[model samples]
Target chain A: MANITNDAAKPERLQLLRVLGPAHVWALGVGIVLVGEYMGWNFAVGKGGMIAGLVACWVAGLLYTCVAMIDSEVTSTVAAAGGQYAQAKHIVGPLMAFNVGLFLVMAYTMLEAANAITVGFLLDTVAGMTGHSGLHQQPFIVLAIMFLAWLNYRGVLATLTFNLVIVAVAFTAICVLFFAIQFGASNVPLDFSAVTEEPLPYGWLGIVASLHFGLWYYLGIEGTCQAAEEVRSPARSLPYGTMAGIMTLLIAATLTWYMCSGLIPWEYLGQAGTPLFDAARVTGNVWLMVLLFIGTIFATLASANGCINDASRAWFSMGRDRYLPSWFGAVHPVYRTPYRSIVFLVPIALIFALGAPLDQVVTFSILSGLLGYTFMTFNMVMFRRKWPLDTIKRGYVHPFHPLPTIILLILCSSAFFAVFLGYGTQLIAMMCFYIIASLWFHFRRYQYVRRGDQFTMPWPRPQGY
Target chain B: MAYEPKKQGLAAQIFDVVTLLVLTVGALYVPLYMGLAGAAKTPNPIENPTWEALGQNAAEQRQWEALGITDPASVNDMITARFDYSFSWAALIIMIVSVVGYFVLVVRLSDREYREVLDERFGSKRKGG
Candidate 1:
């Protein structure tokens, strides 16, 4: 057996402070995707109406559920900070690992950029509501990105502590909106038949179009697995935290869908940039609107914070393994955090936040996520075959074995195609980005090999390799 | 080896069960029931008693005409009734399965022996000693 000392010592050497527990892990899982509850997901309603949109959410929920289940197993078995990237490295090879790592870095950075943009827009809404001109979006976005990146650079615990509080406030706001809608604040009649009747206004193709928006509901739940190295007990905490987090999100997603759609016309909900705020406006309560606006800010911050944390960790892992410059792998001696990577990620995100349109940024984020999911799903199947569950003391082995993994792979592939159909040019651009990244890695590989340092699979290599 | 169950204090056991139940009902049952109730309240156009009740929406009129319902009063009762029944039943099944599935999973996860095995395998090595 390859010694644990050899495989695990590198992260230990980096001296990442171990502080997170199950609760923090759960919060990070939920926090990273909380913005979906406040906005973005309503766009699905425009394409498919309430019923088709809800159906898309159901499929997405199922896909994420399968992902969380397998992720728990892989996380516990590997227990690395690299998260999915590490899993890919062990199960696939160095090339695929580099691709997965880069995909995740882009995915989280794009998600951070999207949240930064949303924060600016929501703050502008607040300003407009208070009878003033909106804040300059570029400055607001840059500041938000910098602030969250600073928090991440300071420490993981600091970032998570802020996340926990913000997530609580955001979750409370969702509950308030759901109740207010249910109690007739909007004066809109419940139309159960609307769920089935003409729910697919754009026809069957609308369901496919809804995939990207539907994905917003549970996009970053897998991020919890990325914190495996810091958690107190990954095998115990990861499965419980991830599963509980997903279940919470499922309920939150359903509530957000039902309340937002029922309170106002699906058409309006679909088009509103800040859907929850619009839903609150239907109540004609200034206080509720204010509350939801605040919630939107909190949700966006939580997402950006969580993304910065996850992105830096992935970059650090890649750097530590020599896929990138070792400069990124350095931990701050005082804070014991990956300050360099966090600082590096913020400027890239700021560029995207200021330069890209909101819809394009969102599409790129989901596209990157889908690419990473595809790799992780394949990695899980390979990992299971290479290291049978019986040999590992896994906390949660997903039921039905390979069935869930296979189903998720198929669903993810179809979602990828749906995304391609919807955003062909953007998808092509993402491929180009990956190709350039791969070529750079190839160049780096040559330099490393010449120094008598070589990249090997983290797991035991197959015979005859 | 014999399977020896760990003994727990009454308070601990109660806390475990209560936590599981609360999580199951709050997270699984509430949102599902909310969705089902919302769906039930949405008006089904074909089930309307009068053509006037279906309203003057052009989309509704086009759908009615496409379905060959020339008169609201003469609309086929079977189609509307079947749709309502199937939708309601599906919602009920989904709610029940979700609640029950969550309950089972939480209970199994709370097992003391299972937790011990997890700690042994994947707990932070720094603190394990």
Candidate 2:
């Protein structure tokens, strides 16, 4: 056996600045999931009534809590830009890491595309209300994608600052909506009957049907982890920031669900393209509606911009690791951002925004996200085995050791199966995508390994082979 | 450092091209075709205003009734049932299996013997590698 040094591994040349603090991490984390307050989440009420939707969200919150805690441990320990991809490479192997990277890229890009399309939908709805039409969704979506990609390419600081401002405004709007529903003067009084209305009006299967929309509440909370390399004192900041963000999202999800449904008929809210806007409209407060409208636009922009940042990071990581073309790994010499990766992502996102229905796009995003969660949870155990607590500089270890990971594995697997059962054909289409991706991986692996490149774990390796 | 392009054999090149084509067609063309076909089967409101208006009115009336509202023209609506029992049962079964499987994995992996074996195989050989 011969000893190997840390210098043997290639030095990181695609450098990203470590400028993000706890506040930035929290804002980005919450901002990525803030879209839940505006739209998509109401679709859960369409499947399950108000009470059932709330219950579904509660279950989804539990799943995300487990995922966030476990992910924070790995993010702090690994402190890499790839997030789950980097974690998986050390715990599992290259093949599984490739699949994880693809899943994350798909999830983030599809989410961005969905947010862009939803912006178009909102604009068209607003236009229709004014007795005008022909908003041309494709052009709007393309412009949104291009704008977000450009913002991301400029630099991470610019992106994070923009995210913080929008998140604050959007969150304040949600808080105002909650207050308006409780005390604002309106012709129709707030109804509490929906809260106790049979809980599961559609039966237990309604829970399964609602899982995807329920997941929207915390869909992109993991985006913070993808920015691991850029966070100062990641070991301390990742856990505190991400966990705070999850708690905030959980409260927002509950309040948004209750206020919107309680103020209007749950069915009307479910069918609304922008439920929060409708909730404000039902209050008969023109000012409230206008405020929420602005919030909706900003929320969409924030979520889309955040997804672009996270997705490009995943693409950049895979390219750096040689999972994809090396061109994707190129960073802007001036801005020190993953410019080529952002450019590569924009067109694909634009295509999705134009081609797919918002429902299908959102479902695909959640499905891919849950797939990534499954890998991350499994990797948590593998990471603990590879690097015991005593062996590493552990800042935050999840309480109860592996129980949370096991429980999360159960929840994520079930959610994946539920998505499959609810959306069989669409899930099949995504499976076809994975097949194609795996085929590409199979061929790429030959060249990748022939070049004598492999994933390097942060932990020490045994003397070798 | 500038990236050096890798040379590939003819067979590998052909395989890559074929897979790329298949992926492009499957991802782009099939979904687009399906969406267009589905859209074509639906009636356009512009072409049949009277029928569409009648259908819309009837839906509005039903929705008003479901909400327990007195006015038939009320915009407020109530949620209705949309569930599949088979899906619920399947999801439940999968969840149960996953929980049990994960528990067993945790128990096995956390064992002292297993840790020792893993340490011997992959743990650092010296103070630092």
Candidate 3:
């Protein structure tokens, strides 16, 4: 039998724990919320599907909580840079890990696209204010993507702080609204009666459609897990930070929905290019609105930067393992950052940025996450015996034991696949074909791993010993 | 043996709490400043019996006169929107408490933990390298 482990390859240098503290870590959580959880979908959805829209976010929140726990466990022990790919590789066989590595490129690249497009959406409003329309037109979005790409390519990461400064600043915009609510009574106390799903916005396909649009809201939480290797002390900070980030975003998102439901109503929001900004006019405070706008700009830039870092790291790992071009693994000698791979990611992301502002991109991103998450959940189950607390020194004992893990796998996987069933009939068929092709390519890459030269991947089993 | 943990000073703790509250209120500004909520409640509809009786009167031709005319010019005039409404005292105080509390606590913490953080960050990065 062919050896399955990557033992023969020289090990990469171990990462030193940088002096990142609670606040820095906390900022990452806030970044995830502002970027991932704070993208405006209330205005994007049609009126009647309001009930489903609300429920979808709630489900997403619970899912986020579950992913955080499991991710903390996986990341606390594993290196942070490679993140889910590293964790998945540990528990599952190498073939699945190979599949995960490829998809991460797809996943992260698309997320960068979503961020650019989202900023483009907000740009439309900013343009109108300056007495110009279509300023956020696709050409500008392209320029923004190129600028972002240049930032990544130009050796900016080495000196960059991990603190998501812009997102955090905008996160403060919520205080102004809270004050207003206390100052004046509500016009309506959340009349769920007016809620409708009749025309159902996008019709029977709305839920799946929204799921795609919705997935963008949860994009960058994965970055925190990837930072596990560089964390001060994973035992305390990792678990708390991951859970805290998810809960914080969940609370903020639910509150945003609850407050906005009757205030702006769905129709006006759906049609309004700058829905939130429009609402700001009612508050009668230009300074407050200015703060929000500036905060949003900060939010996008920080999130984009974080995404580039995480995705490039994933590219670095796969390249080092020989699944991708080895050139991508080249780290800057002085800076210790993956300069080349990050540059490569920019163009891939730009393709999606220039694509029409279809909600389908969000669906594709979430579907990929779910597909990868399935492998992650299954791997944790498979490796339960090997990494049991007795074996691993700092093992995380999940609060509700096997049951929650099992439930998480079932629900999260089902929801992920649910979208495919809903709208991915053709795409799923194509994906199934490509996955088969991927497996074939895997085996073909390693003739030694297959018996009788049929075909094979270097799917070596990893022995912890 | 594990090192003995240093508890944050009362003043520092106060600052931390205040800062966190500031952050919370600050974030909530997104919803507030956007006018997605906090609509001024409509005062109860003016339900005077005379006004109701005036609508039913066959003297509807003189309904404009029959109704109180004390504020005719004001009623007919185009009302301008005022953006500079006085903020409620409660709104003003809660905000002040949170912001002031944050500054005070931060000042206290600076006096206490500044040495430790500096030693850990810039000092250690320089020394260890």
TM-score of each: 0.75, 0.82, 0.67
Which residue pairs does candidate 2 place in steric collision?
A: none
Judge the docking of candidate 2 as incorrect, acceptable, medium or high.
Answer: incorrect
lDDT of 1 by residue, A260-309 (tens): 76555554456568888776765666788889888899999999999999
Correct interface contacts retained, every candidate: 0.00, 0.09, 0.00
If the candidates were sorted by their DockQ against the true structure, best first, what order would they fall in?
A: 2, 1, 3
Task: Output the worst ten-in-a-row residue range by lDDT, candidate 2 chain A.
Answer: A1-10
Docking class of 3: incorrect
Tens digits of per-residue lDDT, candidate 2, A51-88, equal 76787789899999998888888888777887887766
lDDT of each candidate versus the true structure: 0.68, 0.70, 0.50
For candidate 3, the clash count comes to: 27
Clashes of each: 8, 0, 27
> Which prediction has the highest TM-score against the true structure?
2
Candidate 1 vs candidate 3, TM-score winner: 1
> Candidate 1: misplaced stretches above 4 Å?
A1-12, A187-197, A449-465, B1-129
Off by over 4 Å in 2: A1-14, A185-187, A195-198, A449-453, A462-465, B1-129
Better of 2 and 3 by lDDT: 2
